[model samples]
Target chain A: MRGPLSKRLFLWTLVWAVVLTLSAPTFVIIGASLTAGEMLQFPPEGLSFKWYRQLWQLDDFKHALTRTFYVSLICTLLSLPVGTLAAIAMVRYRFRFQGTLQVYLLLPFTIPLVVSGLSMMLFFGDIRVLGQLWPVGVGLCAINIPFMIWSVSASVNALDPELENAAANCGAPPVQAFLTVTVPAVMPGIITGALLMFILAFNEFLVSLFLTDSRTVTLPVQIYNSIRSVITPDLAAVSVVFILIAVVTIGLLDRLVGLEIFLRSK
Target chain B: MNRTLNRKPIAWTLLDAVEISASTVWPFRGRAAVARAFLLPAVLVVGLLLVGLGYIIEYSFHELDITTYRLKDEYSIINYHTVLERPVYLRVLGRTVLASLIVTFLTITLALPYAYVLVRTASAAMRKFLLFALFLPFFIGQVVRAYGWLIILGREGLINAAVTSLGLPTLDLIYTYPAVLFGLIQYMLPFAVLLLIPAIAAIGEDMELASEGLGAHWVATFRYVVLPLAKPGLVGASVVVFTLTMTDFAMPEILGGGTNDFIASAIYDSFFQISNPGLGAALSVILIAVGSLLVMGFFLAAGPGTLGFRSRV
Candidate 1:
């Protein structure tokens, strides 16, 4: 709509200001990571990689990094096929309690994360698996599988039903037809869902905090410990690493399917 | 395909065996069976979580024995009673709700115009830039972002360093109630914006133009046309931001500096510090109840499609 120039200018300015404020923390963290002198400070005394280099010698950080990868990989693997199947059923079939099932699939998400974490912790304790790392992966998978279903459902909804029918018409059985025809068509959705699940699992903190023991601590948990116990440039260096991964992932996501897929999946 | 499979006899045999076994085992002719098979694995995962919630409900009725670090065998309402009776618990609950409401209000207000411009701007470049900035922090999880705030707002951090150099006293910016709220608003802003974009886009530029053609001012158009059209998105974004902020664990823990505790922090302390699982379980049940109530109330008022779900049933 047409408006006064001054009014339009004001709206743009406010938008830009809010955008900058949203990004300020990342800029500050990166600047602090580059400090030449000791201590975390933005607008560093001089540019140096001392903190980044220091990270190599920290065994705790290294172990936490490996554990994080392990957990996230497990989370992705567990969620991927299950979520894909759920998506296919939800999108391609008529079934009883279909809408109720859809909401039930998102149950882990609707429950507060803290509540989920604590409940899982207690449940795992009862089952005698509280401190094991794989259960943490299981917990992460449960919380994140809904994203997988939603993402894959977007693609399943887009698939041409006639293609699968054609495969069947060619004397292919249902399972073979599905494997050959439907899977490739929905490959993009599967990949997107996997990427999102991996990233979310990698970045998960609260659930990890509740379920992990000292030996099984994940990267985010280690970062929390560092924040509470020590103020170091090393922490800034780790944060810079997280920021870089996020930047790279966003770039990849944009290139692969465009960023709007995120809106669709949500 | 035939030549390659002929050259790899083992692969061809395995594919045949798998297809024959599949047709024999499940007989995908039954469509309901196929659908049930497809749904069973995810339902199992959901089943595990439901059992966990069951455990929480069960544990909430028992009392923890601090000396033994084990809950009493006899189920009682003592844990819930303590949560309701304790002044500290009451205070934390009050603060969490108050802060969540404030953060939800501010995040939605800030997000609306940003979403509008991104959706309505004629310039593609401007829209691209806004999406990048919005999604940047979004991909960076809450814990890392909160840590970033620590480096910027800490005592010897950026703000304090600048303040001291300017011949002014340093400020204690981090680890306060307002600091927690500030961090939460920043964290929730992107989510609000993302949720708002689809709703705002649904309004389309034509509606705004039509209103203007009818001689409505920009403000009047925004109020009468945009606001009413975007109600689902606004409500959706508000509910999301509010519930997330209400149960947030990182911001208050990281920025509140051990003084301004939210309900999540209290739950953490009970379970880990005091070794009281029963109390923690009680708090979790309360939190779950409150969150479900809010969501159910909204679903009643705005419908389930607010979150962009298609109501297939």
Candidate 2:
């Protein structure tokens, strides 16, 4: 049942304030990007796509865009299978020190991002692969794989052990049974994990900042460099691009796995 | 068997071999060894970072030689001394801790009702809208959102323009301590809400209804029934928000205008600008220590799963 009118009013005001605070920045960026005037401003002097067109002209942004996709895709690809396997093991078996191992897996996520970035920088520098792109992708993969594992584990945990045992009793081999029965059951979790990992790698800033050189700069780092150098409508234009990606990702996630389940997995 | 052999001869032979191997290995089929085999890749990946953390701990003990870009032969606690003794470092640490406390409190306070509505509201459209508002900023990431604030609060930005048009003075809002905290709270609100959703969802509507039916005022019900039930969520959200804000690099770096640096910013300057890996490593080590201690303290108080790890049933 709904609350009394006064109580409902209070909640409505609080939620609206929160919703506005959460969403206002994207609106401001979108508004600023459409400015005909040169400087970045909200309540645009004249609505135009000049900044968006300007983004198209900039080679640095284009290169950073592709680099970001490349890194995020690589991270997702590497993390999905490994994370799914780990989740299967964690859910489908009972083993020694499993609890300790679970916490060990979460350590990469719990450690301060800056600390992980610094440690990675030092290690990469020592090994002399600091300037390359793949290490950055691998680093992203390592920290974010836990997300994939958790997502898939939720699905794995829901499956009944009896199903697999039944398949075995029917004379289907374990691998065949797993491929036929278990894979379809856990596909939702695998997709959610892959999408979440990709988005994370896309939005990752601190670690990429510490790890990336000019040759390996991702979109976020490139935007950071631009912010430090200048304030212009082009940044607002690119920010709109970021907002669009977020919207699309959210839409896809909601359609695929239902947003409530996605929230629960967190 | 004859029909299967006739259909695909080479494929059958391979399947037969695989089945034979599986049966032989099936003695204790769902065994620890099989689990280990599945876990090996993830373990190695986690190991890679653990080893890096080990290096960070080692690097914290040495001093950087400026001219040659080398660590000193003898290890010392001199870097830690620098972090402890320097007023600048101490100020940054103080500010970081204070800001994290404030941000955590504010984010959780705001997230609770928002999460409640998101979960409890009867309208499907409203739930979808709330989730959209939440995830949009979430997906936009911290860096871009911080930049959005620059447009809203910068000297010639939106708020200033509105004030000027209204014939009032535009206050200097950006590049201050408050601005950094404002951005941090915005960034952290989504995370807290996401974490708190399941916690709040676990508190079934029936419980609230039961409390209300017993003639408790809404406030009393919230105080006794809701808060008591959702204590773990509040604690978990608080811990996550505090640790994340404590090590936050983007908000202060973007909104602080270089004057208001957090510990993460200081670490960055030491490594990239000052060319002092030893100092950066030391700062990171301290950050790690404080974060772990706080999380450990929460675990002791709240038990395991405060960070939302669901143990097996």
Candidate 3:
């Protein structure tokens, strides 16, 4: 009782208290989503999955969910190669403008997503040659590539260059060496980057709001519309679904790639 | 080349093999060359988009044509003038900046002990639990998290229920400025922790041990040693949290309950609700200026820890 155990215990309690307080809303929402009552309430009135059933019956929810998945998938597919190449270059090369290039690649991180969406709409809304989601996809791809670069580049940077060199020295061609050796070394970061991109694109709303029409509404926008207008506890259920999906995906990711690497934006 | 091509008059496979072998034997197999070749397409695309942002800047200087719903032919600074003249824009901007700053401060204050404990604790199970807690909300995205707040902080929400059940007067908690700020703080707390963990982890145990040995209290040791060492991360998180909260549209819209419009909301209203693209562009330009200036100020004040770019390469 007299040692540092007390101090450590106090700190541990304080930390958990903060964590629990911050996370309470999410838990409450999940519980409220399952309530038998129509209105949202915590320690819910009764247990029921009525909202989930109702959410399943909505056409708008279905369309938005499908659109969100499809668009996020497309965004991930387009950005992975582009972002990976850029990440590899940023990591592998040293040139006169290396620093400048790094900064340039990362500038999108600072721009408000709302501003990005508005600007893209201003520039491309006039084209009328393409659909709304296509431009939204492009803008998302743009914002996401830099993040992709940052994430994938970390894995690339962590690699020991000699492993690739050894493959090359064994008479493997550059492409063969890269594919066989470098790819394995950097696969984790690439996968993590791709997953992050998918999640981000799937969840992105501000940019989607600016760019997507009612015809092209994504899930989050759909959710927002429901919240602003009329919707059932189905939304609360959807929110729970979002939380569950995020928790599971991130839990798997925490095991695979380690969420710690996100902080090492070196 | 001539010998390989001699039998390949119409043989594409032979030509492909010959081309591949040529590349295999080519000189100057350098990383820079490969990187340059690979970086070309992405750089071009992203750069062109940046140029598109430049076009928006140009549009901000023009008047909107209500007839055609486009920027007018003649350019003017009248959009900028209107922005400056309207106190609402400045007020919203100020509110955004203030709320962002408040959130940043609260996040750091709340995150510091958590990060310190996570880093210092020898127990793996505890660390994993803390990490799990941190990543769950981070993965949920801003919109869902804000909605979570909606259910909990609503007029007849849980807190109010708890209050009224206790014979205490219920307070107007949701849909106020503080409510939006409260949601922003929660939304940003994870990011702040993620940034701070790295910095705190970098601080060696010896420094703290040494400080304690030298007759310093824990707070004093933290003030002198830990805080100084953790500056890079704090500044980095502050910039990120600030910029994010300032440009955020989702939190304010969902949690603000239609009255507490931040800059991003203002921009959205200008473009869509008001249908003044020029005014929207102007607001955007100003927002960018505000964000960029804040970033630049922090970078100059704190040195190159803004993004904490590694000079390793």
Candidate 4:
């Protein structure tokens, strides 16, 4: 408490040490991806962008990337409205069995991905909807809705209901008041929820593995299959890109809403 | 003023209509309609997942013909018995539980002092930077992070390189128990820090000062004062880390190197590789049961009305 300069220096050093330690892997992968020689040799001799270029050229990786983007995009879009509605209901309503409803809504988050994947596989297979892209989208949407609900609900709790009441009193319809007042008030929450849902869907693998056909194979699934079948610098290259996307997304979120609020809500 | 007056009457008419419909249609009608409209989508999704889970549970107890690759209508407990009686299944289950516990304990231990420092430090910039560093790894993709560890723990990777540079004999670590543990602990440490920071911040500096003024040693103050107050964060963080590690497939699959397997990976293999849906379903049920029990046990141990009780207060 007495010495400010030294304390700051010490704290900075500690932070730098931890960050450097954790970031070593990211650097190593990037270096390995750029290695001129094959076979993932580290200290990765004579760097080049050959592997990265090679990975980009692969049709499967390209298709998987596109599929992953589309699926995550669709899931995020579908989940936002649904999750926002659920959050509003949970926060605004005080009905019987509301607590029970909240628990049920959170059940998807509690269930393991493997179980969810397997269950979806069986259920969809029985209904003849297995091996379709829509089911894969639905599975991702189901898994992501709870996360969106929680985040949006936290923000919803912070909103003042008086604005909506004022609008309604001023000759606005209920839907119009909600659209003009509540929705704008909760936009930050909705954005955060959408970001989370997108990331979850993008990174999802187990569910994709069960629910996706060839037409719907996601990037994570493709990388997973590649890793199992063959060890290549291309997979490492693809992982580098994936990590970059995640890092950029998080950095953007930190800039937009602050990291503390996001973590605190969780 | 005239336009406003005209719109007001129209809006009033709409409200009157809504009121008439609400009163005539049913009791608590307006609220019921609003609630239903809001709750319908969430309830439908939850219902779908529950139905799927219900089917999985039903399938778990039935017999599937190996030759036909079809489910037999006749019910049997053979899958559950097989899971219970087999040494492999039992060993994997025990190991998964043990590994998760170890990882959770390690994460809490490593994160506690770090979180304490982050929250108690006076400098605003330092706190921001520290928190950012802590959350950075979490934002990165899990598979990429796991692969990062694979490189670090590999035969000629960074750890071994450092050891040889220091003139020490290289230790074989990758694909071993230590690798798995290290990967899991690193993966979960950020979560522990995130959870602990708020609780630590909530304690403030006055309590620590008071304890020290009362001549309590640092260790005594931390054990008796800080920890008890931080119990909620500890419980929440531990519950999350334990459950995630318990159900995790990628970490154990990549690091365990055929020498180890968690129940998640086993379930994956049964369903996809072996095509034994019944056995897979049984494994899944067991996994869920174990995870739920662990969470419940943590809550009970932490006491009623504490953290880990429920998401909401």
* C-alpha DockQ of every model: 0.57, 0.61, 0.49, 0.39
* Higher-DockQ candidate of 1 and 2: 2
Candidate 1 per-residue C-alpha lDDT over B51-97 given as tens digits, one digit per residue, 9 for 90 to 100: 88998889889898767879999989999999999998989989999
lDDT of 3 by residue, A6-32 (tens): 566766787988798678878877777
lDDT tens digits, residue span A1-266, model 2: 39788778888899999999998889888888889998776577898888888899999889999998988988898898789889898888888998899889888868889888888887899999998888888899988888889788888877787998898899978777777788888888898898889898999998998889888899999889889978998898898888889888998899998777744522
Best by DockQ: 2
Q: List the RMSD of every prediction in angstroms.
A: 2.7, 2.6, 4.8, 4.0
Candidate topping TM-score = 2
Per-prediction share of native contacts kept = 0.53, 0.59, 0.46, 0.34
Candidate 4 on A81-104: residue-level lDDT in tens?
899998988887777887667667
Q: Looking at candidate 1, what is the lDDT of residue B211?
A: 92
In candidate 2, which residue pairs get closer than 3 Å at backbone N, Cα or C atoms, i.e. clash? none
Model 1, runs deviating above 4 Å: A1-7, A160-163, A166-172, A263-266, B1-18, B306-313
Candidate that would win on lDDT: 2
Candidate 3 displacement at residue B252 in angstroms: 1.6
lDDT of 4 by residue, B203-313 (tens): 757887798789986667788898988887888778878888888887787777767888898998887788888999999998888788877787678742212212334
Rank all candidate structures by their DockQ, best first, as comma-separated numbers. 2, 1, 3, 4
Worst 10 residues of 2 chain A by lDDT: A257-266
The docking quality of candidate 4, as DockQ, is: 0.39
iRMS (Å) per candidate: 2.6, 2.2, 3.2, 4.0
Poorest lDDT segment (10 consecutive residues) of candidate 3 chain B: B304-313
lDDT of 2 at B244: 89
Give the alpha carbon lDDT tens digit for every residue of B184-298 in model 2.
Answer: 9999998899778867777878899999999988888888987777776787788879988999999998999897999999998988898888899999888888878877887
